[model samples]
Target: MTVPMERHIARTRIRDSRLGQHNVRVNPGEYFVTGDSSVMIITVLGSCIAACIRNPLNGFGGMNHFMLPQSDEGEWNGVSSHMRYGNHAMENLINEVMKSGCRRSEMEIKLFGGANMYVGTSEIGAKNARFVTDYLREEGLKAIASDLGGHHGRRIHYWPATGKVKRLLLTGGEDSRVATAETTYRSRLAAAPVEGDIELFG
Candidate 1:
C-alpha cells in the first residue's frame, strides 16, 4: 500500500522572522501543499528535483522534493520509496493541489534543484532532470521557469499560493551539506524494505 500523503508532508516548520511568514523545510522524499499565502515551502537540493506546482486561479499550490527519477519496478514496498521518485512525487503534488479546489488546467509549474553533485559518479542529476522533463511532457504539462543541471546545489524558497520562488545556489560548504544529506538518504533507501503497491514508471 502506498502511504497516504499526510506521512510525506514536511513537518519542519519555522517562523521566518525576516520574511514574517511560516516556512516549512521539505526534505527528500517529502512534499507539502497549501492554499495559505502565509506559508512558504523550502528545500535544498543536490542531485535531486523539486517540483513547484500551483493553481493561479485558486492560489493553491505545493512542492515535492525527490532524489530519484523513477522507482524500480516492484520496489514499492516502502513508504519513503514512493515520494523519492519523480513519477510519484509529481503525481502526488499535482493531486494534492487539485484536491484543494484547484483544477489541473489552471496550474502553473516551476522546476528546480537538479545538480550534478557527484563528479565522476553516475549522472543521477541529469537522469532526474530528464525524468521530470519527460514526465511533464507525458502528462501534457509545461514549466514556466526552471533552473536545473549544474555542478552545484541550490536552496529554494517557494510560496505555493502565489507561484513565486526564490532560488539560492549553494556555495562551498553549503553545497557540501546538500550532497552529504542526499548520500545518506540514498543509503537508507537502499537498506529499506519494499512494502507498498504504488505503480512504478521509467
Candidate 2:
C-alpha cells in the first residue's frame, strides 16, 4: 500500500544583538530584506530559487527567493522591488550591501536550493543556478560556496551578521512530511491575496 505523503516546514532563527529575524513564505515574485547582524531563511523545492549574499568585510548580508526567471510583458507590478528577479536579485543585493557601508568588490556569495522536485519536468533548478553564477561572474562578485541543483527540497538558514549558512535536507521521510505540512501552512499565510489598501504588518 502506498503511504500518504508527509509535509515539511522551513524555519530561520536569528541570534545576534544587531540582527533581526524576518520570516516569509516567499512566493513567486516576493522578497524580504534583513538589516545588518540579521538572518533570513527561505525554503524551496522544484522550480523555485533563492540567492544568499553577504559582505564578508563588514559581516552583513541578505537573501532573496524568486520563482521564475523574469516576468513577461504585461505582468509588472511595483509591490516588490525588481531585485526579486534572478537578474535583479544579484544587482539589488550588491546595492543594498553597499548602502549599508560595504564595498561591492569585497562582497561574497553563497547559494542554495534549486531542486527538480517534479520529475521529468524542465531543469528549472539548474537554470536558476546558472543564472546566479553568470550574474556573479559578470558583476565580479566572488562565490565562496554553494549547494544547488537536486531532486529534494531544502531548508536554508542565512546569517547576515557572519554570512554563515546552515542547510537542512527534506525528503520523503516522515519528518520531512511534517516539515512540508508546516511549510504549506506558512506559505498559505504568506500568499494570502492582499485585501483593500491595508497595512501588511500593522
Candidate 3:
C-alpha cells in the first residue's frame, strides 16, 4: 500500500507570519509528519477525518487527512489507496512518527474532522468518527481529545511537535466550499450507494 511519498505528502509549505512558523496544508488523501518545532500541519475537512498524533516527550508527531474509513481497492481515481483510507492513513502516520524515535505507548493522540455535511444523505462523518475511535481502541491506544459529528466542516491547525491543535468551523461560503470539495472527492470513489437511514449511536 506504500505509494511514493510525493503523492501523499503536502507539497506546499509556507511561513505563517502570525504564528511565525512553517505551515503545510494537508489536503484530502494527504498526510504530513515532522519533528521540527517550527513546523505546523494544517488540513480542512468535511465528512472526513484527521488524526493528529505526537510524542510529547520527544516532540515528534504528524497528521493525516483521510476521506473514508477503509478501501479494499488498490487505488481510487488516481489517489493512493493508503492516503484515502483511515486504516492506512493511521498506520502510515503512526509508523512515520515511530520512525522519529517516538514510541506508541508514549504517543499523544487527538482526533478531528468528521463533519456531516449532507443532512439527509449518508452519515459518512459519523462513520469516520466511529472508525477512528474503534481503531484506536483495537490498537490499545486512546485519543486525548476529539471533535467530530456535526453539520459543518472544519479547518484544523496542528502543531505536531507540540500536539496543539486549533480548529475553526467552516462558515459562510467557506463551509459550502468544504462540503463541495468532499462531495467532489467522494463522487470519484467507487463506494456503495447510501441506502436507508444511517445514524450514529452515542
Candidate 4:
C-alpha cells in the first residue's frame, strides 16, 4: 500500500544545492534517472532503501527509493506497483542506463539509507540491505560504496556520470521530517488493498 514512486518525482525542477544547479527531489517510494550532469537527484530516508547506480562510459545514472524489497508481497488499491519495490527499482534503473549505452559489467553501484529508525522485529532496514547485497551478487556486480545499517537517517547526493556520491548523516532537526515520512508510509501500508498477508518494511 505504499505510495507509487511516480507520485513523488514531480517534473517541476527545483534548485536543491548551493551550486545553483537544477536538481530533482525524490521522496519515499519514488525514483529518478538522468544522463544530465546539471541535474543532481537527491532524497532523504530513514529505514528506506535507495540504490544509486551509474554507467560512466555512457554518462547515464539515476537513483531509486523503494519501501519494499520484493514485488509479490501484495497489492495497493488493487494495483501492484513494481516501481515501489526494490527488485523492480533496481531493474528499472539498470535497464534505463543500459539502454543509454552502458553494459552490466561497466555499471558502478552505490547503496544508501536502510537505517533502523524504529524499534520492531520487521527489520526492514536489514532486509533491504540483504536484498541489495543478494541482488548484486546474483548479477555478478560489485559495489563501489555503501553506507547502511545504523540508527540514523541519511541524505544522499549522487553524480551519475562520474559515479560519485556524497552521503550526509541526518540528525536533530531531521527527526520530525523523518518521522512524518515514516508515518505517511506506514499509514499507506495499513491501508493495504489485500487486507492482510502483506508485509511492509519501512
Candidate 5:
C-alpha cells in the first residue's frame, strides 16, 4: 500500500530541533531560499553536490542540491533543465539570494559533497568537485571553503543568516541512507527523463 504524500514527507524529515524549528531540508534536484536569520537549511549528500550560499550583509541565503554538471551538447531528458545542473543551480541560488536583498559581492559560498563512492566507474564525484571549483574561478567568484572529493558522504547544516556551516562527514552505517537516496535519484533520471514541476517544501 502506498502512503499519503503528506505523511511520507513528514516522516522523512530529520525531526531534530538542533537545526531550528523553521529549518528546511533540501532534496536532490531542488533548492531552498530564505532571508530569515533564525532558520536553517540542511541536506545529506553522496557523490551529489550541494552549494551553501549566502549574502553576509543582507542575511539572505539558500542551498541547492544538484546531481551532475551540464552536458555541453544537449539537455537532460526529464530532469528540470536548470535546477539539476551545477551551473544553473549555482546561478539560481545566487539569484534567489540577491532577490532577497543581497548583492553578489557580499555572498559567502561554501560547497559540500562529491565523494568518490563508486568503486569501478568514473569518479563522478571527483569530476563534480573539480567542475564547481573551475566554474567559480572562471566566473571570478571565490568559495570561502569546500568539503569535496573523498571516500565518504556528508551531512550538511548551513545557517544562511550567519554564513556558518556544520559539515559532518559520514562513515560506516551513515553511508547506507545517503547511498539509497542517490541510487533512487539516478534511477528516476534513467526511468523517466521528462519535465515536471517540483514543489518547494520550505
Candidate 6:
C-alpha cells in the first residue's frame, strides 16, 4: 500500500531565540522549559491542546501541549508527567511556572490549539477544551484569552511580560489565521489514513 504524501511532510516549526529555546516532542510524558524567559511559544494540532501560562508580575511564562486527557490507562509508564493530557499537563505546567518564581494568583492564561484534527473520533478537541476550562476554574485561575475549537492546527506565540498571545493557523501550507480553508484542510486530513505510519506509534 502507498502512504499519503501529507503524512511524510513536516507540519510544525519552532523559532530560535537569543535567550534560548526549549522544544517538547510528543511521547505522552516529555516537557521542556525556557527557564526565566519572558516569552514562550508552543505549537500544536489535531486532538492536541497547548496551554500558555504567564505571570505578568514576574515577567515569566510557560506553555505545554498534551495529546490526551490523563494517563489513567497506565500505558505511558513513568513519563506520563510530560505527556499532553489535560489534567496532568495543566497541573505540571502550572507547577513548573510557579517553581520558576511565578505565583499562581499573579499568573494569567492564554489557551490555543485543541483543534479537532480527527473526525468522528469522539470529539477529542472539545473534550480537551472542556477539561482545560474546568481545570482552570477548579484551580481558581482565569483565562485572559483563548483561540480554541474548530478543525485547524495553530501556532501559538506567548509573551509572558505582556500576557499577549498571537495565533497562526496551519493549513498544511502557508501560515495564516483564516478559519474556513484551514478547517477544510484539517477535515480532509482527518479522513485519510496511512499504512505503517509510525510517527506516533510508540
Candidate 3 is scored at a TM of 0.81
Model 5 spans with C-alpha error above 4 angstroms:
1-20, 69-84, 190-202
Cα lDDT tens digits, model 5, 1-202, are 2211111021123445774546578888778776666667788899998888876776677788877633333455553343236666677676666655555666789999999887777787887788788778976788889889889999998877788899898998888788777877866754543344333212
lDDT of each: 0.77, 0.55, 0.76, 0.70, 0.71, 0.55
lDDT of 4: 0.70
- Give me the displacement of residue 24 in model 3, in angstroms: 0.5
Model 3 misplaced regions, further than 4 Å: 1-8, 69-84, 191-202
lDDT of 6 by residue, 36-68 (tens): 343354554554667777556555556676655
In model 4, what is the error at residue 103, expressed in angstroms? 0.9
lDDT winner among the candidates?
1
Clashes of each: 5, 11, 0, 2, 3, 7
Please give, for residues 148-187, the per-residue lDDT of candidate 3 as tens digits.
8888889999986677789999888998888888887776
What value does the lDDT take at residue 85 in candidate 2?
52
Segments in model 2 whose C-alpha atoms lie over 4 Å from true places:
1-28, 36-42, 69-84, 173-202
lDDT of 4 by residue, 107-199 (tens): 788899778777778777777777788778977888888888897889987777577778898897795588578767866754543222323
- Misplaced by over 4 Å in model 1 are 1-8, 69-84, 193-202
Note each model's CA RMSD in angstroms: 5.4, 11.5, 8.3, 7.6, 7.7, 11.7
Ten contiguous residues minimizing lDDT sum, candidate 4: 1-10
Ranking by lDDT: 1, 3, 5, 4, 2, 6
Error of 1 at 134 (Å): 0.5
